[model samples]
Target: MIKNYIKLALKLMLRKKYYTALTLVGISFTIMIITVFASFVDQIIGANTPERNRSRMLLLDKVSIYRNGKSTDATPSVHFLQHLPKLESAETVSILKRNEFVSFLNGKTAGHVLQQTDENLWNIADFKFVEGKSYTTDDVKSGARVAVINEKTKEHFFNNEDAEGKSITIYGQAFKVIGVLKSAAAFSKLYGDVYVPYTTDMNLHTTEKAIEGTYSAIILSKSEDARKVRTELRSQMRKIGRNANGADSLKLYPFSSIEQFAKSSSSNDDEPEYGKTTIILLIVMVLFMLIPAISLINLNLSRIGERAEEIGVRKSFGATSGALVKQFIIENVIITLIGGLIGLGMSIYASKLLIQVINSFDPLFKMPTDTFIVSWPVFAFCLFSCLIFGLVSGAYPAWKMSRMNVIYALKGGNSL
Candidate 1:
């Protein structure tokens, strides 16, 4: 029975080739756009590579002080790090300070992200090593000037030469390149072209205030432990706020890997409304899908109207309304499924194109990956969306066909 429905659906599709092509293009194009956009979003927020442990990570990246109705914001302080309460839930913790370093090598000038971080940053945020190894805890404690350079930096400075044991000159300071890493995603907390011990940079470790300075902290733990960890960190931060001399109101901002990016674009600097941001994103995607589905419905209505005579003939031959509806829905689903496959292929190609276009702009924008990998879950969700798309657009037209007067339908009219 299903085979017959598919055979008829294919025959009808070929009968009106241009309309079939138009419908497929509409569905395919919408799927391609949404898939590619979602893929990039997953790359940024979802656990991809070095950020694989993101689901279990918490970051206290910012702090704010309210003074006399004015707001002063800064990175979480070294002082806060120095006095952090024991995070019993944490698997690993890191103290990180970010700055830019300029390098002039082989008459080429480039700026690189210089992350002054403790060795624990290596533990909390996974960095895939191309060669050599990350600086050890002993290296950080002794203020070793060893550096870990990313693959892009390796390309820029060495030009395909082996980087380990080589010396890289950054900001007129010579640091030995002890490790080379695959470039992490640009938006990740671990994002940097060069990583070195914070102990090596006196400016980063020097505490300017008890609650405000240029540093941040990340804690990684079991997924179930995140809430407990955040609660403990907040309590500790509040204690510091109460104990500090001449302290106004001190507030710590805690965020997950995804929430950090979501909240970053808020107009308010004090506290972010990320729930609204999430809702807005969901609505935008829904609207995009809805427009294409609406077009499909209108197109289906026109095509079904042309099949009024067929519907009347089938009804005359004792076809039940339920069976007719089922057949039409099956036909729509088949077309949508075909369009989904085309969309899947197009999305993969478009993702690679997008990556190339982004990297074409500048060296500083270079990320690790060349291919945009659409995760299985993402594609699966899209597949389910296609099924829903098929049923919804098919239903109304099929119902309308079932309601038509048998005599009018025989005369090729839609009168009910």
Candidate 2:
């Protein structure tokens, strides 16, 4: 029976080429837009590269210092980093500061962004080394002028040769390259061309009785331990504020996922509106699909009206209304599923083309073409959308046809 339904659906679709083409185009475009949007969002939130342990990590990128009804934005300080180790829930904590890009001159000069971090950051971030090893705590404490360069930096300086123990001049100072890292995507937060110990510069450690400075802390902990970590952090902040003598109060805002980071960047609120953003996105996609679904539904109704005599004849031959409804629903679902496959193919093609175009113009972007992965979650979302589309566009037409009076239907009279 199911095979017959599919066979009949194929025949009918081929018989009405115009309607079939219109429906397929509509469904395919809608699904393609949806899939592309889903893939983009997944790329933003999904873990990659150095931050692969993002699910178990939290970022304290911004701090709020409130004084006399005014608030000032500041980065985390060495004070915060020193206290994070006391938290029982924390696996490891790290601090880093964005440094000025220094000119690297061997034969040619190139500027690269440098990040100053501690040894603990190496443990927290999974930076894949290409040549050597990360700097140690002893090196950081001793203020050694050692640096780790990324793959791009290595090529620019050494031309595919080994970079380890090579002296590179930066900001009129010579530093020895200790390591080289694999390339990281531009979207990654921890990506940098060069990494050095924070203690190499005394300016980053300049802090008075205040707790605000130019440093950001990253907390590495299990997902289950996040609540405890937050609680402990809040308690620690209160303790620091108590000694501030009514001129200062500190707050630690942690962004555990891309969504949180986006919300924080977009607004001044401490809590991210993840649920609201999710609902709004869902509504937008549904509305996007609904426009085409409504048009297809009307088309289905008109097509069913043209086949009134056929439906009437079959009904008179002991074809139950339930069987007719099932067949029509199945036929619509088949059309939608086919459209889904076509849409998936189109999305993949579009993504590749987009990557190629971007890479052609901007070599410095460093974006991976394979970043848009079609994971199981994406596949499931596509199937769910297809099912909703099938039912919305087919249900009313099938029900109306099922309830038609045999006498009127046989006489070529249309009624709803």
Candidate 3:
């Protein structure tokens, strides 16, 4: 029975070649646009290479100090780091201080962003090493002028030769190159040309009895331990506020995920924003899909109207309205499934084209490679959406045609 319906659907599609082509193109393009956009967004937030442990990591980049109800924002200070309470739930704790500075190589000056961090930063944030290894906590505490450079920096300064044990002058000081790392995501917070120890920077580790300065902390823990870690961090902040002058009201926002980080960065909220953005995106996609679906429905209604005589003949031959409705619905679903497959292909091709175009315009506009993928769940959602579009656009037209008066349909006149 399904086979007969599919054969008839194919024949009818072939008979109206122009309409079928138009419908497929419209549906496929719409799906392609949505899927590609979704893929890029997923890559930006869900990619697991740079922030490999992002799911189990929490970032505290900013601190808020309230004096007479006027709030001031700054990075956490060395004092805060020194006095921070022990977190029972965190497995690893790391701190970082990043700044842009000029480095001299072969009498050429180049600006590079440098991250000053401890050995814990290496264990918490996964950085792929091309050669050598990360600096140790002993190196950090002893104020060793050792550095780790990324692949780009290594290529630019050393002609991609062995970077280990080489010395590069940063900020008028020579630092031994101890490690070379693979390139990180362009948008990653940890991205830098040079990584060195925080203790090596006298400015960051000054003996200041303040709770606000230039420092960020990373907490790594299990997914289930996130709440407990946050709670302990907040308790510590409150304790610090009680003793610090003009900082009696202090707020610490620990971002557990990219979505939460974005929200906290944009506002003071601690709740995740991705869930809200997801709902908005779904609503928008549904609205976008509706336009093409409406067009398909109108085309189906016209085509079904032309088949009124066939319906009458089938009715005369004792065909049930339910069976006719089912047949037409199946035909629509077949068309939709085919369109969905075409759309999936188009989406993948378009994403590659888009990346090429952007990169051509600017070579430095490097997006993360091998990040975009149409995962199984996304593909399944696409097929499910196709089914919904088919049913919505097909059902009313099928029901309407099936209920036509037999005698009027036979006369080939408008039944309505």
Candidate 4:
């Protein structure tokens, strides 16, 4: 019985080759677009997880003071590092200070400030060492003039040569290369190439003022409970920096929290509604699939009308409604499944073409390598979507074919 249904299904599909082709094409295009969108969203969310030791909590000044008729925001201040005792309980605390207009080897200029940090800075950020090692406690204590460069910096300056133990001039002073970092995503603010000891300025530059020149301090909690640590740190900061009314209004944020805040703040006020965008895309895809499905359903109904005598004859010969429905459903399933397989193949080819187009762009603008590569999830998702579409689209047509009245259908007076 199943074999007969499949045979009939194949004959019907072959008879309407143009319709089958159009349905498969529509499904393929929709699946391809969905796959690409999923990959892009996955890549964007995954960007925040590049470093293994990303902090759960970050310490920043919360107080905003007005001085000289100008309001000063102190939420992300460096002074919190010096006075906050809550940081001592933290798993690790790393101070980051930037020095802009710093010169490097061969008169290469940097528009951004060079970051200075202690040995703990590397541990706090999970900086992947490609060559050599991170700065040690001894190096920080001795105020050694050693630097670590990121992969981009290595490519920019040393070319193919090993950067380790090489000397690079920074701010008219020579510093030895201790390490090179692997290329990292740009989610973190520490995307700069050069890394120097936090103590490099002890002898060269000195300032007693707390807020004179400091970038920010990052504190990593031993446990995942960063909010608790942040609160404690804020309370300690309030004690250290007393306001006129002696109130503490400092804010502390976990690393992930800040990212959400940044994204929300960065969204354009006039952007289209997310629900509208999603609904529009869904409606379009459904319409693309719906037109073909409806046409196929009508085609199947017409084919049934022509074959009404056959169905009526079978019913009179004692075929049950259940058996008839099963036969018709199986036939439609076979036809739709064939179309689905074709669509799946087309989707794979289209996805490959899309990835190639993306990779042709410069690395800076291109999608991440992981995202560009099609994984098992992509194949599974495509297969499932195709199966659902095929079954649902064919169900209505099969049902209508199964519901014929034997007497009327046998009379065969243009019944549909």
Decreasing TM-score order of the candidates: 1, 2, 3, 4
- TM-score leader: 1
State the lDDT of candidate 3 residue by residue for 343-386, as single tens digits. 98888888777766776775543443433456565677777888
Name the regions of candidate 1 deviating beyond 4 angstroms.
66-71, 107-109, 205-210, 222-225, 261-275, 355-364, 368-372
Evaluate residue 187 in candidate 1 and report its C-alpha lDDT on the 0 to 100 scale.
Answer: 55
**Deviation (Å) of 291 in candidate 3:** 2.7
Report the lDDT tens digits of candidate 4 across residue range 120-192.
7777675678899888989987989999887766765687489999987777788899898775443345544
Of candidates 4 and 1, the better by lDDT: 1
1 versus 3: better lDDT goes to: 1
User: For candidate 1, lDDT tens digit of each residue in 1-416?
Assistant: 88999999999889989989998999899888878877777877788767888878778787666666676777777766766777777777788888897776678778788998888888777778998999998998898989999988899889969999999876677899999998876656678999998888867546655567778888786564456776676676677664553555667666676666676767664345678778877887788688999999999888766999999999999988999899999999989888987998899888877777776787654554543578787798778878887898898888888887888999999887
Instruction: Provide the RMSD of all predictions against the true structure, rounded to 1 decimal.
Output: 3.0, 4.1, 4.4, 7.7
Residue pairs in clash, model 2: none
Structure candidate 3, residue pairs in collision:
none
Cα error of candidate 3 at position 174, Å:
6.5
* Clash count (model 4, backbone only): 4
Runs with alpha carbons beyond 4 Å of true place in candidate 4? 1-49, 55-71, 75-79, 97-114, 201-208, 211-214, 241-249, 252-254, 257-416
* Reference-based TM-score, model 4: 0.57
Give the lDDT of residue 85 in candidate 2. 36
Candidate 4: deviation at residue 42, Å?
A: 5.1
Clashing pairs in 4: 61-75, 62-250, 99-113, 100-113
